[model samples]
Target: MTEQNEEKPRNFHEMELDDRILKAIAKLGWQNPTLIQERAIPLLLEGKDVLVRARTGSGKTAAFAIPVIQKILNIKQTARHQEIKALILAPSKELCHQICGVIKDLTIKCSQEVRCVDVAPQVDLSVQKPLLVERPDIVVGTPTRVLKHVKAGYLDLKKSLELLVIDEADLVFSFGYENEVKELMGSLPNIYQAILASATLSEDVKSLKSLVLHNPVTLKLEEPEIAPESQLTHYHLMAEEMDKATIIYALLKLHLIRGKTIIFVNTVDKCYKIKLYLEQFGIPTCVLNSELPAKIRCHSVTQFNQGIYDIIVASDEKALEEPGNYGEKDNTEAKKSKRKKDKESGVSRGIDFQHVANVINFDFPLDAQSYIHRAGRTARGNNHGSVLSFVSIKEKPLLEKVENRLKTGDNDSIFKANHFKLEEVEAFKYRAKDAWRAVTKIAVREARLKEIKQEIFNCQKLKSYFEDNPTDLQVLRHDKALHTVRVQQHLSDVPEYIVPPTLKGMGGLTKRNKRKHDFRSAQSSASRFQARKSNPLLSMDFEGFSKKKKKKN
Candidate 1:
């Protein structure tokens, strides 16, 4: 591949793109090009293959998307419906929809001339056939979905396609889509320009580079994997398995963590465990793990982004051990019957969780990349965000390993000890223990079952049918509570009498109206990383976490 670097173009106008494209950029309020856009756009417009490594939320979508739209617009002016001019492949269904959405936004003015369709939905081929029949200029989907379309005679990337972009190239391999990618590449027209955009140049990404790129210009930016220490503050709090719930409950109840936030857990079980555990304390959360269906997962993110929910409990990455079973959350007969990981279920990496203020690692990430993807969810687009990880005693080694990978200078660990000591929330001890006890293993499993069942019926095609037949929807509705968690209503409200002095001014953001008022007032106060610090944990003695405690087993 060609190893030449081009001079940076300061803005979108400098790239000599179509005027309509520039107008759309202006409409979107993009005053200047991001580093990725500045470097990658010009090369892409030049019709050269590019392998880019930039941080997430760095406008990577627009970097390749702008050129793709511009070229299609230009072609539409002269050519008679240039069918399938571009194909964008992502790792998950959520990301496919996201990329397609970006393209549609950019083509707002040119929508009539240049159309894009997301072929990643888990709907029937017959359902999507009409859209594919129109032969959209831009088709976005995961590798398998795109290949499925090609095999089913719905998409024709072998001839008319002029550009191919593999967004989140690293994840395509990790998701075990290398074979689909290779097969898709072989069937594609060899002369089409390609762009491989990813956060890292992992072995998989490099392999993708060799397979698709023709003397591609690799753009590895000097930026860090995550936002800098200033924009994104990283903190790790030590907590054992049992007390993790107690700490999270106290933090959210007292409003220590605020703004739109995502709590990342390791296993699918942990996603529900923290979510259901918090619910016992009257904290509501949306679960966005791999167990949920694609349409529901995507809708959950959209709703979360639109401020419908303040918190989302999600699993960040794939399975660490087996390749195929990666991100596979359940081993129940229903889940085991289907070998495919939730095609729509993904959070980190490609799917954008907009304006996220905080990322709490409820379970310390299994790997460094998982942590990076989780961290990338927040502090995006020049916005300030924070990461607070709960590290247990044994997980300290994993923490060190993650910090080691993040080291730029000697001994410069990116994650530091969280200054917020768990001790200050001692007032909530009895309540927290009471709440934690109510969250049983049965509740977690029940929560998973209900989520899976509801989402199964809520899938796009079925939902459409149910929309016309509303009574059927009502008939299939789950009326019963998923779990028997003895939710104590008093746990939802923090009485003013017990309010800690340090956290006094906020008025414990428990009440909805008061919380909104306090939230706005707090936002106006220039306290972005506000209220993180608290005193040390008063007692690990409450549970089996104490060293003096005997082994129950």
Candidate 2:
């Protein structure tokens, strides 16, 4: 709500940014710099490595984009466009596209002579080499695919590279991508400048500082301490999974929350199940999970972004994974609960929506970290957002833990369905009756499909369990082949992460093994919960009082 403290540059024309870019800024009626844009862009122009931490919707993209665009125009003004001079690594295909689109739009408005293009994994691989050889002054893509091009000798980095940006570093590293990122950094030319941006930073990100940047300028913007009271409200539901759907249905029927919504679940399979059940109740909804085809997933996201769809039920993991986690490859624990896996899955951390007024956790996050990530999605960009978390008796400890850790000033009590006033919803019901009916129908169809998918998933799990113990060759082989087929299908559709079909060899699997271990290999003590990490910054403490420790173990 307060103005950002950073100052804007005086000579926009002399900054190397395209004339059209400046014109667009002038045309769009932007008079002064946003706090982030004002502060971050100057450092970027100086070619200093920057590590920016700002609230989502704090004009973070423009803060970074202006500099990148300026660098591109500067390059074209001096060097030939044959070699890619800058790389912007985003965590999702949609974001890559979004950034690219923004750059293109800005370039169009800034002046007459500037042009920009976006290159992502969704584009044909065959054309990639040619595109890099031909145009593509600014290359924006999901990390894995971009790295794949680098690995396969398709992208040449030997030319005079100016900038390397890792957008959403928190999501990239938290979702088991530390190694991949480190590897990518190792490959970049030594002289290139780096910029790391995120809504928040974790220890993994801190670890990245030494490896990628040199004497970086740090820009930190704290989100408003007070969330907007009018746009969002917080509520909790003590209900069973089945009953939760009914509550969601009731909320939909009442209608003050009319625009398209995203329902967050803990697991990938649950995304499908929720979509199906909500559809059965006549809500027009779709599932956005990693398991779906890439085109379908992209379409789902595009539709959601364009406000074409009303409700999207998705697992936190799927929405967050994309370039961050890669593929439908669920972690070992994710397979076990699907409903609640902490930061290991990347779902909770990745979702970014400025328009979302409500964030309903179909299954409450198991700890404070999940709570922070999910809640962070809404109330972004200085907007007030609401949170509705469903809790069952089985999850009380987690709910209590979250309340304590977040220092949620309110009392921790179960809210029944009757407490919410849905009368405001009924009025919108009449105004958008047709749209509502369509959403209801889609919700029902998606629910039915989800039920069928769940049955298949259950059958697969049973097949794995029944086959044998540690060395069931039959089950292992069967699961491996099935996994291979699934991976291939997913890859053919998305081609983001070209990881081999086998999941065991990668170092990423060690923590995964502990999570999936049977009762025999795993310790049965409550200590596991106590020792487990919820957020990189905050560890879970079943017993309420412990001084916050930032030291890594």
Candidate 3:
């Protein structure tokens, strides 16, 4: 067994990498090796299967990528048809594309030709089949797509496949790709080297070691400290469920969010709703959810990184649906099953969001692990960042659990509690309320209109009648009810009010007493109804029952 703590290389150049590869590293302005790079690169070059546990932004991508590129370069092949030497599987399409980009960058100056293909949902499989036929040296993709290609005979991994890399291994298992991964491993050569890397290795990943790796070297990097060196500030604010949107709006209005910010929610519905609410306030934002098309999701991330958008409202990638081809089946049960699968995807893992200045937990995470991942989005690679969580009264306990996990042995609190006074944003609250209501109303109306349009199109008689009576079509187009909900006035023009519900002293009343009070109110109403039914004067007095009867008559 090799020493786990062998003398590490001082720099990339000292690692005995090809001069061309060294030039590419220098071109990227990397002066020294990151800890993970320095440790993992050498062992990987020595042909050792490694299991790595390192925090995000630790240069783990390059740690494995550099060695893979070098190994491919070292292989001397004279055959016309090159086989895939390395297979890298990521949990999401975004991560797959990202890994491919890193590999391309590292192989820029290599003398030997290297063809890297990214097979993901965003790229058509039919298109990828031809590329696979070109005998690419490296393939980076999501597990499902890779498996699909392998099954379709478009990809040949049974022969000439030497190395297998699983990035974000914990996420890969959590996303329910264990079966696909197992199948891929079964198809590969038994003697191939396997590398699994993740921030945290859960029990599932630990169990996977016996099946895939043969006495692999485990590298567990020290977890990054939460505060001082990372310059990450944590703030937790309490707000009512209804007031959360308003508080977020106020935070934005006060310029509290500096630089590119990501607001994390636990559900897709909240992700879109918050996005619409923020946009209603004239804040331009994009939504990153699993339900979105692959191209749009990729474009959203690209635009965000390019500084085209300042704010992005995203759901936890785990809440998104898995990305792949489900074939042409439109059955109800199949659709429902697909939806359930989508809610379990872990798309957010392994994605690199460059220069994120802040992360706001719009919806408090269910557990501590989720909080850690959300906070990991910011404070990456020596960058200063902040995380603000919108904690409701009921969610305080969950917040406390996260705080306890983040605490070092010392008694000092890692998360600071910040009070968000309602009075400070009283005016903005009402405006936000009205804006949300108006947006929801418009959405409902549009959905209703779509149903009506579909019904009309589906009815053969109605379609022909409308075609014959063009004037009726014109009248339908001008229907006032169809356009009832319009953005005639801005939300800022809405009136403000303080209407906090009073729940004081409610606990003092027993259930029996509440039932008695309800009974008395019901008796009084019955007596009044009996009096109105029997006496003409009583019926005519104030109730206006006689007036309604006379109008009907």
Candidate 4:
């Protein structure tokens, strides 16, 4: 493994790339290559197999995408006929779709010469056969999906395949696609140039490197996994398990944590638990988890990037530290139903969350790597961000692990004490309970069921989900927690008395400022809805809520 961190200044024009590729990069508004792209692109273009260990949001996708497309174009120049030459496999379906989109964007100028298709194994195999039948120059899908197609005779890649890319390589085995990956590798032509790109060098990643790369030139970037101290801030608050809800309630309802934020929780149920508790006070939030349909998950991310919602409660990180949601060859016994976690569907792993200003860990992550990846969502692209975690007495050990990971770097400790006193917002405790109380267990169950039905039965998009599991009985096990978030408009407003005392010193952010922020958030949501009527995904479930909101007014 080679280590290279020297970032010599270089631009897209400096690299030996095709004119059409350079033109597409300009259209995407990329002024220069990122450090990872600058270092790895030249090596990949030279046909050197690479094992890349870089953090997320480090432009790693384009690090491989640009070279992959350049090679496809290079092949097309001399080859007489087109064939499936490149295969890109990601752990989750969402990541697969994202890579496909990025590849397509880069191939805009040379689309006629290079073809790419992103497939989701979660979807019915029959539906994707046509996309595979075309024999695209590049095929992007999960290892499971790619293997299924190859076995079904829909995709013939035993001979002409030349390039293989496994993005998010650490997550491949974690998602329980190890068997599929091994089988797919056994079928592929062994002479192809390969790239195993991952954010971390976990045991699984090391195992994959031995299996995938061939005398590969390793590039372990010198950049710290965590952002610089100047660009981001970290804070920790000690709270009892029972009062955890109260702390987050005070933070958001009092306008303490400002800007677009992502609140992270551990279980799928917790995602809804927080969203519903906030919703009881007329807060608008979206729930993201693995159990949800792929379409809904993808659309939620698109709307979030577009600023349709400021707060998103997501169940990720260790939420995906379970088995992949595939293959029900075993009998439907209670023990066998543990395969509910969708390895490919995680918000924390990689989902392209743009301009996220804050990441609040409602529950601390299970491991150091989970914390690192969750933090990766924010402090992206020269933008400043903050992560505030609620640490309970029991969670102190988890907190220590995260702190120790950061201690190896420049400053000793990154996690700071809570800037604001919890006593200042003590008056809001009863109100927080009132809101939290309304999020009954029954409500969470209904919300979970309704969410599944809305995306599955209503949209009929869970072809892969249903195919793997014989019944929805297993959903009840993991989705036993969650809440319906719509409520009266009066609950949305923050009463003047609920303002914390010491917090007033920070820009005089009184109750009025909180209201002002809410008003602006609402205005943006309404404006975005009016601007794009054709995008119904963003507008889903708003009509009924608006009617009730108007009645409350």
lDDT of each: 0.74, 0.55, 0.67, 0.74
Give per-residue lDDT, candidate 2, residue 69: 75
Residue-level error in angstroms, candidate 2, position 267? 2.1
TM-score of every model versus the real structure: 0.86, 0.65, 0.75, 0.84
Best by the TM-score measure: 1
2 against 4, candidate with superior lDDT: 4
Find the 10 residues in a row with the least total lDDT in model 2. Answer: 477-486
When 1 and 2 are scored with lDDT, the better candidate is 1
lDDT of 1 at 60: 94
Q: In model 4, how large is the Cα lDDT of residue 482? A: 34
lDDT of 1 by residue, 383-427 (tens): 777788989887787788789888769978777564444556666
- Could you tell me the TM-score of candidate 1? 0.86
**Model 4, 319-370: lDDT tens per residue?**
3333223112211232344536565676787677877777889887767778
Scored against the true structure, residue 198 in model 4 reaches a CA lDDT of 91
Q: What ordering of candidates by TM-score runs from best to worst?
A: 1, 4, 3, 2
The CA lDDT at 362 in model 4 is 86
Clashes of each: 4, 26, 1, 2
